[model samples]
Target: MPVPSPYALLLSNVMVREASVSVLDSSTSYWDYGPPNADTVVVAVHGFRGEHHGLDPVVAHLSGIRVISPDLPGFGESEPLRDLTHDIAGYTAWLRAFIEALGLHAPVILGHSFGSIVVSAAVAGGVEASKVILVNPIAAPALSGPNGFLSRLTLLYYRAGRALPPKLGGALLSNWLIVRFMSLLLAQSPDRDLRRWVHDQHHTYFSRYATRDSVVEGFEASISADVSQFAPSITAPTLLIGADRDPITTVDAQRRLVELFPDARLEIIPAVGHLIHYEKPREAASAIVEFLGDGAVAVSEAAA
Candidate 1:
């Protein structure tokens, strides 16, 4: 039997609820998990070409804290931004508004991959958060070599795809064969079953969640983003988690990020790649729970 799609499995789970919020004149869709009245609210953000469900595994292991994972505009069920650049600054602005609209004050902001960049930008712009957590955070250009080269190549291919008619371009970019091949190349887990599942999840989401314009814009934004410059402005206590085997964002890069922050620490997960949350959710959740401590508890009663 074939494995179930990630979204299908996610829907079957009871902890997750589909929700939406209006911000910047667009309806932003998201997944809300855990108790609504939780004292700790985690605004979880996914990577490029990713949807809220990508982080479902990690959220499953978390208790007490409510996790709100948004489908960043133009990526999942969320509506694309009108007449705005899909870069770090654009995302940062939207995030600020989204948080305020939801009445989330000093919520714990958790970002992964591209999401990390967004969180960093928001914090740098003075968006208040009690704490910030970056998972598989992308490094500065100076620290990224082979990964940077690959990213440029991807952007070039995306640009070429965009020049074609919408149908042809979309089909070319969303080809299952190409998506599966890329997934195989990116998989770094030693477990065969886990690798297969990750590949399946990537293929399913990449095929539908993104458009050529969004992909191109997001890639361009990432390459040009410089979060280090804004590090000193961030006052929130920060935790950085890096995967030992992640090629895109190395552990060394994560260390460099820690150095830039005023109050930050780093932890490296063993034998995992960039998809640390999916590959080792239990371990990741444990580290996060320990870091958050009593702050993650929903109620004073739960804390005791």
Candidate 2:
């Protein structure tokens, strides 16, 4: 059963379609939103354990820009790369290849959470982008901040999942109880309805991976590196929308991250956490619009 998106009304008029492209020997599934000929085209990368649907709320707010949100290799509908582990290096290479396949000249790029690390690495490694936006960016290493203890537990959880037999491991990793618990950890919103929806989204899509090994490998990439590692190498102007209450990356850490980039600014949103795309999409869209200028103005108007 598909849970209805609360933002459906807002996106009722938006043109959206499923699009696919061959990149690195995988047929990538992506959602193409807004005007095809729009001047502002954002290649939005979603976080770990998420598909293109995870970023749909933010897409709903951005009325004018063409946002191409893809299911990273091995996650959602996308297949795993033919001969690469789903680590930072593999994902980074795939992103660079994916963008090149699109043939868009220096399109604006955006990433959320784990996607932040991948995008940062891609830009640092020579994928061109006119501007960059990170939502709830994983600014610091997962094991080095206020949430270190939680991250450790998450590591152990993954380790246990990988240790089990393939069938058992996949079942354990995708268990509804565990998925809901993770959703509870990240959903800091006071609104009960919002929190429930966030949980619903996680429960529905969090475990839709190509394989257990790929998922664990992706988790390793997420925790081992962050946006800060590649920040200094990214020369383009960047916008980071941080949640003051984010459990995955503290606001203080995000502030520190902003300093690592030569031309980056941070926008802190209150009363939200790691799930900013689901809980505070409008705010995220507004920050992105402001950073993107005239080509992104329609999103500001739509959000307002």
Candidate 3:
């Protein structure tokens, strides 16, 4: 089977419009899809180093829901924060502002990888969301265990890379060869089409450096995060999706996350890695739509 383009798949389902919203001193770039007056409104947050388009695959599978995927500050077309760490607290504040600025009312917040941490923090910090969905939430220390040594080493390399001159550091961190190798190593899916699609995405989006400070700070923040303190305070219903084969955020960690939330359920996606949405968009979307309950509309007209 031929690899299907994620971008093409996304555009076929819903018309994506480029828009910008002012958040504090900076602005955020986002893609607005689906009907504006749809019954369900989903604000999807992409992972670290990911732009708004990163969630296109998942968005393609959703129907009758307004999906707003944003390129968080310092990524894609968004501007970086002037003097703030791209840490959980910082991102949580930004997310809160973004939601309020757009007048979202009890919308479902969906986050993948690093975005999961942001969503968790936002809810914990009292952002009013009807529900929260976390895909491959980072487990921090568990991510640095025996099976995660390579990832830890990579983080260290990023730290070193950040110390270099701007141009050299950007070039070193966004090297195409390195990005492709990392994508291959991280991909756990056996499907050739999905793997090829992931590789192509990495080549197109991952092998570029637009914000060095955000990359460095985001890496540090992810490693140092411990959401256990406030995760239990979240009042919104939560869905935690864990990839069984994920090397970075282990399934064990996701279970712990489930424990932290008062009203949260865990769903494990078998045989996939951290990039669950990229590898198994349909499955991920099904899990999310199911979790959303009666309010979610089924994808009756999806792109093949």
**Candidate 3 lDDT over residue span 1-304, tens digit each:** 4456844644585767888998878988889988888788899998878777678888877777789998878888888776677887788889999999898887999888888878878888889899988888775553446746775787878987888997888788888888888898878887787789888887777743357778888777666665555578888988888899997766777787788778989899998998887887778888888998633433433432
lDDT to native, each model: 0.78, 0.87, 0.79
Which candidate number maximizes TM-score? Answer: 2
RMSD of candidate 2 to true structure, Å: 2.0
**Ranking by TM-score, best first?**
2, 3, 1
- lDDT per residue (tens digit) for residues 33-103 in model 1: 87788778899988878888788778866776788988888887888777677888788988998899888
Comparison by TM-score, 1 against 2, better one: 2
Reference-based TM-score of each model = 0.90, 0.95, 0.91
Worst-scoring 10-residue span by lDDT in model 2: 294-303
- What's model 3's lDDT at 115? 86
Best prediction by lDDT: 2
Model 1 misplaced stretches (Cα beyond 4 Å) = 1-14, 142-144, 295-304
The better-scoring model by TM-score among 2 and 3 is 2
Off by over 4 Å in 3: 1-10, 140-144, 226-229, 294-304
Clashing pairs in 2: none
Q: Report clash pairs, candidate 3.
A: none
